[model samples]
Target: MSSYLDGGGGCRKRRRGGERIFKFKSFGENGCPVEFDGSFRNNVKALVEYGNLEMNLCNDGVLCWTFQLEVHRHPPLNVLLFVVEEPVRASSINLHCKHCRYVGWGNHMICNKKYHFLLPSKDTVASCFNCDETNSYESNPEKGKLNLVELKGHIMHGVFHSNGFGHLLCVNGMEMGSDQLAGYQITEFWDRLCTGLQARKVSLCDTSRKRGMELRLLYGVAYGHPWFGRWGYKFGRGCYGVNKPIYQKAIEAIQGIPLCLLNHHLSISNNEVSVIFSRYQALSDHSIVTLGDLLHFMLKLRSRLPEENITSSCNPTTVETNCRWSPKRVEAATRVIVEALKNREFRWVSRQEVRDAARAYIGDTGLLDFVLKSLGNHIVGNYLVRRCLNPVTKVLEYCLEDISTVFPNSEALIMNNSKAKPRNKITKVQLMKDIGYLYKHILNDQKPTMSTGVLSAIPMATRIILDTKFLLKEYTEEQLPIRGNSFKLFCTVTLRNNEGIDEGSKKPMLPYECVSFNENTTFDELRQEVEKCFREVYWRLRSFVVEAVANMSVKGSDLVVGSVEMGQKLVFIGSNDDQIGSEDSSGTGIVDCLCGAKEDDGERLISCDICEVWQHTSHALANADADALLNNIEKWVVIMMNLQRFYLGILHIFTCPVVRNNVKVL
Candidate 1:
């Protein structure tokens, strides 16, 4: 047991500055084991600042955080009960207050025999109401001071003892509706006893009877070792073989053993057996000797015993086996297997690779099992069907609520609108089919749940945005490569310009959206062509045609137009009104109604401007032999269209002054 020094201030009610004091009561062995008891202030600064930001896209944003600091004086406890017989109802046992109320499959009662076994100290008697002369000792102590061990003398088997445990009551290794032990210092006392028991059991085993007799005779006289204070070896050579009487005698003589001589066995002369004892002892003059204290001392000596033994006759061995087909070679043969799956490449891994990983992951049988399972499934017919159906089902179900917002009329535009409906109304059969499809197709059995599929996609979406941004920067700098003489570059330039003005196109554009154009023209020719297209497009938007601009983006081979100058030059010329119609507009329609009847002045219809500027672009083909221009013709066309409109509406009007004057005359 640990030495407990008197904590000053006995039950003083003084409160330190800024510290709140609560009633402190200790009923267990060493009183309250927790040394520092203070309430903590809850802080929320982190939550306020960046709580919703995630470490990674796949991670959840932190919502809340809390931490508490406490000073404790006792060691941690490890408790296990070895039941030896059928249980009874009213069996007495010691149990923690919390465990006594546990209701679960493994819940059991802890026997409380602590109070009866260990004699109470003076303070305990003074605190215990049962010991009072007025009580006649007929009844148990007050409920608060009830000792589980003295409750009902229950028969317990293989129960480990510890002091300072808080218990309500124990029966059949189960709580009996009340605590039997309260505030007991069980952790420190129990661990010390266990350590001592282990040391004694292992240290006292005799290989020969001579050694045992020698120890017994030597212990017949009192000697001292730290644990048994003035002990004799009457308990025999091996500590385990000692009887209770010999055990007690040896304990008494242990204190005489010198600390320096405790580690080595005493050498006996031919005339007499020499027994060395250590002056170092468990119980000093200051405190009363307790069983726990003695055991603790014994354990300290046992622990200091050296580990040295000579053994001969065993031969070293090595194992040799062919592992050519082992899963241990999975990584080494990864490319081989991957190509094999897609019928791409096939190669065997060296035997050495298998040996290396196997040595490292000695007992990882599960990895092998998983590999085999995956390999076996590769040949299954349902894999493809499952993959396809699972995702489709999952996505549809996941978006159901969002989809429902479009409803009745909104449902008409869904790919499978006939089945789309609000959740509660969705039938079990439909739900199962959708869920099954999603699990099979979209998630590919990797993430069978709807939530998981959505979660995995979040990181992917973030990654796409980052990738698009990188590609855009590279394209503008004309540092990216073009594969061939295709219209890919031109299409990207067009879409990139389009995307800057279109709010609907905020999502990264897909590869299929770009249009390829001819590459034979010079950069100057392309600039002129673009200007022409712009002029043509300006005049086309004469009415309040509020058209929705959808996704316009640059992708592979189209990065040639990623210049900041090019980005700023692109312009959208459409009505500021809200008369937009859906591209796939069956379910939803837009209605533009000017609620305020007061008409705006016709001055609002000022002539739309079309602007033009000549810019040159240089194309560098990665493969000079192919000489692919990878034209930016479409973007050139759109740009020219807008510019042409601006020029025609302005410069061409100068060419036809009467037509412009008629509008002014009105």
Candidate 2:
């Protein structure tokens, strides 16, 4: 567990001399384990400048943002979960956490448990927390501390305990070392006297004796070396016996394993695949419904495997039977699978792929039983589908609500990123339900329910915004997806000035709306939606979300959006007489803070003699460096006095001859 030392940041309450104190708290192993290091001002600046803005596009309009700061040592390791009221406001945000999760790389095999189980420190201080009086009766004075081994009865020696761990194991004939006998006697005698600290109901040896392959499943804590390989050799020394590859490989994988299909023991006999399919067909009588139902039932049984690290390019090893599966070849196969899925050529989930993942995660006994049960208690099907989903959008979904405006930045609790194996906890039915829930929120303007991922939300939002008009009609959850016939998606995809804006003859489009539609109404449609978001949303807003205060009267408009730029424009959309939409600015539509706005004085309201448009003097002077805006010298005299007045923050309109001649304010 990491512990944060002395740290500070640019606190809201800065000291008299402009000194900012940034304080952070790290939780220890008991609940708090953290450490943070960074420049205070630099940290605040990054968050304020580049944070992702998030908002709930519901009637109960909410707004918020997330800020991430990279640790100096590891760029991917982020330190703060800074959630804020608004993206640009640093002082009004909440600091969610002060520590970051470790990124366990360079290890031969990175598993999920790496994040949770930290190695015990050599300097571990053991004390009796359960006892009121921890002091010993003896005045030895060194009585407060107890050794970890003393507090916990004993460490369970695995199948083969060599070196430092040898004393904890008992052997049949080899003379028991004095130290080994001493430990065995103490453990057997103290089992009743020990507390609940390091107690396990049963030991691994009990299971290992009945099933020796149990050691193969301990790759997580194992150094991945076959320290127990010699123990298996005790059963035989000849090539006809345990010296064969079958006996040696499991132990070798626990030690010197290669990265290949054979190493994973995943290849199936060509006849095996046929046998499985034929058996399954016999069981189901070729009925698609029975097959589908069985598959569905079996898929739900899949569970997460912590030890597997699958990438986008991973595939089943069945194809590698004749040839070797090098990492490169495996990657190529993975790409082919992805492309096939993208093109909708065929729907497939590799049985071998699922099996290998289960093997990596489960004990040999459980793996065998799971495989058998998946095959319907017979040797029918061997596919594992439980933890099949991955966090593809790859980030947690966020929402903004009204409170004291507390923004808690919660980085993912899991340290593993996209490289980790996909989750098996969710099923297709559950995923579709989540998507449908969000879909209803998008079209009906109803409140959104919490979802599993931001990836799902992004495309749902993109589709909702892009297909607004088609969705104008009220829809039942069942009535959704207006399939087959193409409906216009008012897409906001920008075309360069040189490119054609109109889509020739494909679909008619309203000029103001940004939308698009597709024939696909299933989950795959989400992938397209994510693509659209990357192009339209991620680039435009950096990330896709905003602040929405619960119970706080959401202002600026009748409708709320997740965009700052769009929100600003929409706020002025229907305001016929709002101060910012006064008739004086007439054709200007809405004020462009970046450009400037005009007043209706009809005179001395700074006018560009060249372009003859109303302009701010400060803006004109600021752009004098550019040859275009303030081209000639004497032309400046026409608006010189008005420019200074405008610079002084006065909004008095001298006049706009374009719309009116009267000095309205005067």
Candidate 3:
């Protein structure tokens, strides 16, 4: 589909009125005689087919000559030198047009040697070019002369200057790229070995600090590599874009310091590092700042200043120091940490500062000591860290809060009362808010709805948490109800007035009654109501039979309810046909099948007494009754299936298409 300009500046000859005027252009160099292959028509046909364009070939059985000019020599096709790919099939054409030959302006010029021409795979040779046979050919096509300027604009934009791109897209604001930064310096190499830490820019008065970036940037940093400093620039230039080998090598170089060296005789265990991570679970739970960031910062901090007033104890009781960012914030957070530890609420602790302190005090091994200081114990810190690190659980918790807080703020979908209220009082604006609230709530609930509850259930207040902002909005707006701890906002109920259908004709009947319910009601309750509604119909039909056919033997007087199927349900009665053994003279007899039975004679009935008695042997739909329904089934099973399907709001079974005759069936 994508065609490149080729051959004689990609000149396309146009035909007028479905006819082409035969015209030929000539190329050669410096007084050399060139031969024509005498198959120009065939070659022209091949060219047309190859280019997927339709054109007619002209052959009046006369040799016509065009202007002769000097141009670069075209290369010969070497079949043995070519390696073909079955799928791509892009065979190399060795167009060795290094120099052109010019010959006299006679009708035909003769060369002393034979020249092999390189041609694209088309059977005909009509449009083929002839070459002088003087020179020996090699396989490589680079030997040919090329006009590089023609491809310059195609490869890169005219204004593309590497230095002009000021910033690279980041998780937050566009960060200054290496090209834009002084000396294009990449300060540190962060690899998989380093811990990932999260840092947030101080927010303005109007915006919240916890707002997430619209897009995430997945980056790997490695220390001490030549390319490390130019990562931003190289990435911007798209240099190692999707080439796996180049990208991997660059990534490896970025991880400058080998991970093995960092792990050498490290006193603190990973478990200790994990504890330090857990202390600030709420903040890190959403986007965890890796320990690597803190470790790197600590290393830089240590290098910046000589160790002074440093305690000699490996695990000192306590140390007071500035936080990672500011001394004032650190002091405030330290007090909170101490209080959190005293209260045994480990979730409130800040692990980043503690980790930095631990690394400084005991060479990263004292991380355990720091966590224990905040957590009060190693076991508790580990447990707390695990809980905070679970992103899935955290996301679910956030969604629940988001939904509950906004639920009361949602506008009502007024079905019954909306019409009664004046148009001005309809709260049209609230409708949009309600729709937004419902959309978010449903989207958030979709995950839990699809999942089995047992897997994600937690003892903590993991469910139904509300966002304070949304809660306040709901309170001020008077949009939703204060329903229990979870706000109960009223939603307009949809009233479905289902029509009945004809029995014999099986046509849909008109609207009989309306059904309405709260939007918040569970699906199971809805299913139960539908089952009950269908069961009423089933029972009514059974009663009709009991009254109409008194001659037949009857089972239990009471009706037994069965499982709720799609649209209909099955009911059973007491008494197996075999148990009664024979029909009693005083006992009842079956007059006719109440279920549209056919007559064998005018007076005599065709209904079997055994079948009538045994039809509903299961008096109760208990587990034991399953066996009775399984035995001695009736032809009406299909009808029951259809009825059940109709009741369940899904009745596609009756419309199943079957093949018949020789024609296809719908």
Candidate 4:
């Protein structure tokens, strides 16, 4: 909300408290705007998005105004323009803007092992602090000096010049028109760019190489375009201090007229809240306003917010406005208002809605009570809703979650006074070290806790990538026996070379190598033959799973134990060579089949695939499609679909033990 304030002197009357106030403040100027890249500012969108352009207008002539947030590379600086038509008869009035671009920069941490920082002697210069130290990022270069690489320009060391600011206040008699109409954002262009006078004297500590800056200079001139450079000042008169305000005012107007708020990519805080309040107060003094006006007002006064939190404003000197106001109450009210603003109840209509709701209440006292209660009960837990992520914090959270979920406080939930669940079991601070191990063994990253790359020679170092830094801290040869159902990880290590330089290269030689069970089967124990098909390492080791089936085929079948009718399994007893003739020999070969041996031809046999059993004709007909044949499904089942099933030779049967303890569903 800053404007480039050039000297534009005049008189304007603004209505405040129904009294006319004439403004002739010398701290004023012509509207020489300092244009910044205002393309994608979204500060105003924080409020709420309107469904359509029609939603922004109201019968009270309340129109939405725009203000661009200061952000880098946000495009289309003047994407939207908003102007409230002023009365044709109103006197000509102009308001000046003073743009204030801040100076100074913050030191950044080096990306590599060497400590890096910006040169305080010259803000743009970059340098490293640990170039020659033992831990500095490097490799063997020459015999004498450590390998030092010089980084040039600001970006080499990384830069963080915080968002620069702009200021807007009355420059002329614009109070001539009602503040409501004039408050609508008007985009206008200005001219002129300036540069710094000259470089200042620099004192470098050649020995230490780096020192933090004590006081940061607040230069009004924009970067590269310092207005003082064009002023033609002499070293004799201290011209920089004298002409800073004048040059700053002139440079403020050098930007294209900004129309509306583009997009605000920066986070919002109480500072933005304060700015909004100030603007609302300024405009509302002249006329009634809407929620959109309040939004712009917040952006205007956001700069005035105190730099530090007023934790306990016990000191009066630190207070602003000559300490006339209590900082605590002001801050509290400001916070509460911001909290309410997060809720979208104050949209659509304006002051009229508030008045209507108040009048609709049972009484004025009742409305006041409700307001007080609502304010008191508000939680105000998360003041600023942000979606930013911090990697360090996220890693910490993961560690905490692993500990909490798997290792609870042993007090499992109770049920009917009987123990129902397991207890807390993971040992605290059990580390899996990698520092010394990795320094010497750089090629492989497979750890005892992981079973991921057991077959592959290449080590992906899954444990390192998974943010277990807390557990991978200290180096130790001692092993801690792990006990817990919370996490099931097991591994064992063996090396082919256990002597000389190759001893440390002892990797887990077996794919099924684990803490509890190590699979190292000898060749003799395996049968005379092995499966001819190709298989992966894990599957090859588990080949014993099919050994029983293979043996059954070569030797004899194993015993079959199942739940079945007494006579169902041993249906034929001593009878054999069963294949009964079809009842209708020509209709279909299956229609006349019956069960019995060839010698017991006409003994009323029941037809079937596995067995042809001799039974009475009535029994053979009535027992078809019966449960006595299915035998509890889990062990074995004869799916008899109908009484004619045997006639159709549909003696389909299947068997398997579904209740095995080791069966895994997925």
**On residues 123-151, what C-alpha lDDT tens digit does candidate 1 reach at each position?**
33232322332343345323322421233
- What is the C-alpha lDDT profile of model 2 across 1-666, one tens digit per residue? 111110122211211343222211211111111111111111222333333442321011223332222223322222222222212122122211001100101111111010000111112211221111333414432222222112222222211000000011222111222212232222332221111111111111111210122222222113221223222212111111112222223222212211121111212322222222222222332121211232322222222212233221112222334534343443343333233223322222233433343444343544333322222211101221111111222221111111111112211111123433242123434433432332233222222321222112222222212211100011011111223443322222222123333333222110112222333332224224423432231112223222222122445342222222121111001001111111122342222222222222111235555666654444222232222322221223223323433432221121112112334654
What ranking of all candidate models by lDDT puts the best one first? 1, 2, 3, 4
Model 2 scores worst on lDDT over the 10 consecutive residues at 110-119
Per-prediction CA RMSD (Å): 44.1, 35.8, 36.8, 42.2
When summed lDDT is taken over every stretch of 10 residues in candidate 4, the lowest stretch is: 395-404
What value of lDDT does candidate 1 attain over all alpha carbons? Answer: 0.23
lDDT of 3: 0.21
Candidate 3, position 388, lDDT: 22
lDDT of each: 0.23, 0.23, 0.21, 0.20
Q: Residue 383 error for model 4, in Å?
A: 7.9
C-alpha displacement of 652 in model 1, angstroms?
A: 85
Candidate 3 wrong stretches, greater than 4 Å: 1-220, 223-228, 231-337, 345-666
- Residue 449's lDDT in candidate 4: 24
Q: Write the per-residue lDDT of candidate 4 for residues 14-91, one digit (tens) a residue.
A: 111332111111101222122211100111122112111221221122222222222112331111112121111111
